[model samples]
Target: NAGVTQTPKFRILKIGQSMTLQCAQDMNHNYMYWYRQDPGMGLKLIYYSVGAGITDKGEVPNGYNVSRSTTEDFPLRLELAAPSQTSVYFCASSSGLSNEQFFGPGTRLTVL
Candidate 1:
């Protein structure tokens, strides 16, 4: 893809279930990030990677995990899903913090 791409546009999970949200970018960006947006709220960062094999927790990283094994892929793992995890997740990539980030369509997740 030319920009950021995320799979599974929508999903529903039972409590305690787990799923992976896949994200990729073909632009060879050095910075990638995951964010979650709750109803009536702005996007909150979950995790971010400055480059492959380097990652750090953001404002909200609980119950979520991320790995950056390659420049193009940064996948977020949700383990033991809970109702509190329900939100719209987005992936973004950018050449640098000063540059604009390109976002994916987003994955809407619901947990009961």
Candidate 2:
């Protein structure tokens, strides 16, 4: 089965610019999430959605936003980006809160 897919494996964004990271899965899962991993640091949650029309902020939701309008798509938005936001972003999904998540390779974002 096709798991998760992310675009522009690498990206460079100027400070104060904006971009959207796309994430899609064909696993028919119900839980989707966005997270950022920095050098020498663990992943930090940005946002998650339980289902269409339902969304919630995670640990480090600042500077980012998300929306879930369908079962297979969950996109993350970065507005007025800053250097601190520079990190590798990963998109993951699980069957439920207690299920093990499957992750995409990742998108490396560099904000200069």
Candidate 3:
């Protein structure tokens, strides 16, 4: 089964535009998360969901939103993109048993 997948491996967006980053996991995990990594910085959690219909904002959720209507899918929406939002975004999932998360390849977004 596919562990996790993210669409649009790379994207270039003009400032103030909007986009949605898709994420999917076939592992039936109970928890899913969205993270962003900036140049020379560590990964920062953007949003997370504990299960279907249960979602929460993470450390950096200012420019984004998320919905988890199913265990396999969690999509992140960028309402109004900004240059500060330019980073590599990663989707992750975990069964919550061992508390280890499996991450997707990542989506590189550039805002000019």
Candidate 4:
């Protein structure tokens, strides 16, 4: 799969629980990113990786964490999930920062 793929598609989380949203791509991309889209809204960056072992936090990284140990994977860890964390998550990848990304379908998470 050269394109990014997200797991579970949808999830329900309790107020203080945790979950890891999986993301992966086989396109040999150097830039991988995680973003959240509010209900019917645009996307907001959460984290990004330029390559293996090089990761950076994006605009909305307060509730999430990411690691880039391999070029094919860029997973997001949500610890002590809160109601504010409930949103649709998307994983995207590009050959480089100057390039356009290929987006995955999305992971919809709800906190109750």
Winner by lDDT: 1
lDDT tens digits by residue: candidate 1, 1-112 = 5688999999999999999999999999999999999999999999999999999999999999999999999999999999999999999999988999999999999999
lDDT of 3 by residue, 1-112 (tens): 8789999899999999999999999998999999999999999999999999999999999989999988899999998989999999999999995789999999999999
lDDT of each: 0.97, 0.93, 0.95, 0.93
Backbone clashes under 3 angstroms, per model? 0, 0, 0, 0
The true-versus-predicted C-alpha distance at residue 9 of model 4, in Å, is 0.4
- Pairs that collide, model 2: none
Give per-residue lDDT, candidate 2, residue 89: 98
Best by TM-score: 1
Ranking by lDDT: 1, 3, 2, 4
What stretches of model 2 exceed 4 Å from their correct place? none
lDDT: worst 10-residue window of model 3 = 92-101
RMSD of 3: 0.9
Encode model 4's per-residue lDDT on 1-112: one tens digit a residue: 5488998799999999999999999899999999999988899999999999999989989978899999999999998999999999999999987899999999999999
Query: Which 10 consecutive residues of model 1 have the lowest summed lDDT?
Result: 1-10
